[model samples]
Target: MESQSSLQRLLSGPIAPGELAWIGLRPARRASMIPVSAAKLAPGEGLEGDHYISSRNGPRQVTLIAAEDLAAIGQFLAGAGAQPEQLRRNLVTRGVNLLALKDRRFSIGPVILEGAGECAPCGRMEETLGPGGYNAVRGHGGILARVIEGGEVRLGDPIERIEEDISTVLARRRNR
Candidate 1:
């Protein structure tokens, strides 16, 4: 019998489900984000009508931020927290730790997304949030994801991790 690796077990830890609290999309590069109640996620492309729409699929098809982190950022910035639109993430999630989703597949409503990478803060953060904006968002910037199964996601949707069996996780880790 194959023994379970501690690393794989740790990676499979359970997380409390979160909620999709907000949605925002930019029609063009450097454009102001438009808040929406619902949005369609296109597999291999991106959010419909968003500037990230493309023919090829890649990391960063979607961006997300934790609402708690937003509050933390507000506290860091002398209580002047930026809004979801100003932060420019496609989805604003609450009650879940974004860092815990790294390298895992998760779902928001019917849409599935794979953790891709960190959403690094851009130089525009300074312009968007005033002085120290870039620094303020450094660790609180959120995460990037690739759409796996595209579908419509709406505000108040539940964010749940797609748990994999221990054997499957071990096999994948071994292969890596």
Candidate 2:
């Protein structure tokens, strides 16, 4: 077994920021997502122009997938190719472990987002990726989040972790 200090050391390190690689918005349910270079996010709403805008006040206002996961999913599907739009996520990022952001706050460009939970693969994934699509995205579905501060998010924006006390963060989230 590893020592406590070793475990701490393993977890403690500079955050590896991610870059926004793609943005997509579904204007209507069961519709394909339209690619965009930039988009505006609103608190209590999702990405502007997205179908979920009117009903996305909950914790899952936005969805994100890592670029690496997309690649892995593609490989898992035997080079079937997993595109961001097909995944139906609002943002596709590179170089960040989105799962690590759960219950934490992060910033993308001028927007601040609070991680809500893991974005589990939906049944629709089968229709999107075909045959094994659902299974391929199971553990790689990325994360769900809500906008804490509204602002514009553009492609290539950096996704960074925000350092804050847990209690204070919780208190702030509760007030929102």
Candidate 3:
């Protein structure tokens, strides 16, 4: 047995679980996102009814945003909290640091997703959220992920990190 370094321990520390607060699906490009209580996730494909689908897995198989971030975006403009659909993200989560999921494997119920990168806000935000919309979402756009294991993701499903830190993984690789 060996003692762990403080930084390593901190990186591997526990994260409080969060629940899936909302779900939205875009039926087609430029279509209004429809709020849904549940949706099916298919590996290599996106949400069953959502338009952003492909035969092969991609970085943006699905997109998610934090509920807190949405509120922050709203505060930037006249105390108007934008709706989940207005953000154009596939899911809206609450009570969790979504950045923690970046570059890590996390699970939403039985569905597994590997955080691909930051879900940068698109120019469309201006049109969707009104004035200053794009700037409002600048640092709070949430994250995008690729589905590694597919299953149903329903509202109220628990979201939890189920993997080791990427730093630990990189260290192991370097040592080997």
Candidate 4:
């Protein structure tokens, strides 16, 4: 069996972004999942905002942020003895490094998310997590994906690989 940490979901956001923001359960009583897409990190954007990962033909937009920045946040919070779980990232996947998934494809249930590009950190990190967070995930290849099919994704969902070998994809990028 795979380790518990190996399979998990990951959704997160700055405590506050431009126009103010917060990562919380979106309003849609029956909808457990939201479409994920790729987009530039504007001055203020997050998981629950209007641009929190959307779709071109449907109700979805890109949800993104720097992965390395997240690690930085985790590290700082860890150093200060701040409970990392308190940060409230929906899924904390391990082993299947996120940066490697850039410009690739991964399946989340029936939905296929094409890794479009990186989601860089913005000034919001400095505003929310602290000044240091802005430097945390600068170019770590944060994930930007668009959902090809809609599905239900809740907290603790496992990030499973169904088609392409993401390890190779991620490895190739790492070698670059």
Say which candidate scores most in lDDT. 2
Query: Which of 1 and 2 is the better model by TM-score?
Result: 1
Computed on alpha carbons, the lDDT of every model, listed in order, comes to 0.87, 0.89, 0.87, 0.41
- What is candidate 1's lDDT per residue for 1-176, written digit by digit as tens? 99779997876778999999999989998888999999999988889989988744788889999999889878878999888887889999999999788778888997878888889999988888889888889899899998877889999999988887535644664586
Clashing pairs in 2: none
How well does each candidate superpose onto the true structure, as a TM-score? 0.88, 0.86, 0.86, 0.49
lDDT of 2 by residue, 52-115 (tens): 9897589889999999999999999999899998889999999999987877789898788999
Q: Which scores greater on lDDT, model 3 or model 4?
A: 3
Per-residue lDDT over 40-152 for candidate 3, one digit per residue giving the tens place of the 0 to 100 score: 99877778888888533688889999999999898997798888888889999998899888888888987888889999988999999998999999989999998877889
lDDT of 4 by residue, 95-121 (tens): 355654555555442334555666565
lDDT of 3 at 86: 89
The Cα RMSD of model 1 versus the native structure comes to 5.5
Can you list the residue pairs that collide in candidate 1? Answer: none
Off by over 4 Å in 2: 1-13, 165-176
